[model samples]
Target: MGTTRSGEAVGTAFGEYAVRPVRVGEWAAVKALRLAALRDPVADIAFLDTYEKAVAQPDTHWRERTARAAEGADGMRQFIAGTADGTLVGTVTVLVEEPGTTDLAGFPVERRQGHLVGVFVRPGHRGKGLTEVLFEAALEWAWEVGVERVRLIVHPDNARALGFYRKAGFVESGITLPLAGNPDGHELEMVIER
Candidate 1:
């Protein structure tokens, strides 16, 4: 995959959709997509945050979040898939973790890597290979940024996502992260080396 500008369009099976990093001014769209994702049926296991929590956040929170990701600085970038008419239908964010730095889970980062998070696609856009396109753009960016490998954590109960990740060439890394609320629950870590 080649590098794409913020609004450059890419053609996919369903139609013309742009798979590119979001612009800083698109904070409202980012917040809306996130809220929609949180409302998904599998969101409880698929995401670490809740719709109520995200919806309650102020505009400044969303603006700052989008600004940071839009800047692609601090090792974070968020890519969104939008239709020709400018409707955002999906998103995926990549966060790079440096060696010796602790991850969000408080686990020590043993190597420089890209961690995929906040992956989501609208229900109507499912089964059309849109997720793969999104992943390709994200992985391309990650590899270009010098990550040795790319990884994502999925809850054990999210069979749909687990199947997709496996099919996408990610293998279990033998790491399990304790779930935030459920002491007995854990997320399985999957990785793909560059």
Candidate 2:
């Protein structure tokens, strides 16, 4: 049943699953999935925001967030994976960064690129090749828009994510940022050039 032009179903272990952008009216779904992600066991290292803070956000915030990444947005896009039953199982967002602008970390963008963020998959859906499929879709969008490269930040202790990103053709860029809370922890930057 998943067959929207922008939301083609990618093959999955159980059957077919769609990977597409979030819709304007689907803010609730986006908010729910994000809260679920923040509740995940690895949330501490996997995400920068706390579950408490995310849940505290007003509905308008979620609405604006979804709208900014919806199908018509120019600077960002959020891709979600939906099952045959219409349940969202995972998501990823890509933000276009210009060379002259600064990023969330206050560092110069340096190059026009796609910054991948809000990456997640449900606990039950791990290791089914679904993540790779989602990534393929996101990267396709990034290239379609002419990004020079794509990059994501990962905590050094998050071995699972590091392994997955590496398998997906990303390599260490030799840039690391100090973690805010823990002085010794670092988030390593990984990139894949077009």
Q: Which candidate ranks first by lDDT, i.e. highest? A: 1
lDDT of 2 by residue, 15-104 (tens): 477777777788898999999999988899988899999999999999999888885476898888878777888999998999999976
Candidate 1 accuracy as TM-score: 0.93
lDDT of each: 0.89, 0.85
| Residue-level lDDT tens digits of model 1 in 18-83 | 777877888999999999999999999998899999999999999999988987879999998888
C-alpha positional error of residue 181 in candidate 1 after TM-score superposition, expressed in Å: 2.1
Which structure among the candidates has the greatest TM-score?
Answer: 1
Ten contiguous residues minimizing lDDT sum, candidate 1: 5-14
Compared with the true structure, model 2 gives a TM-score of: 0.91
lDDT score for residue 84 of model 2: 76
For residue 81, what is the lDDT in candidate 1?
88
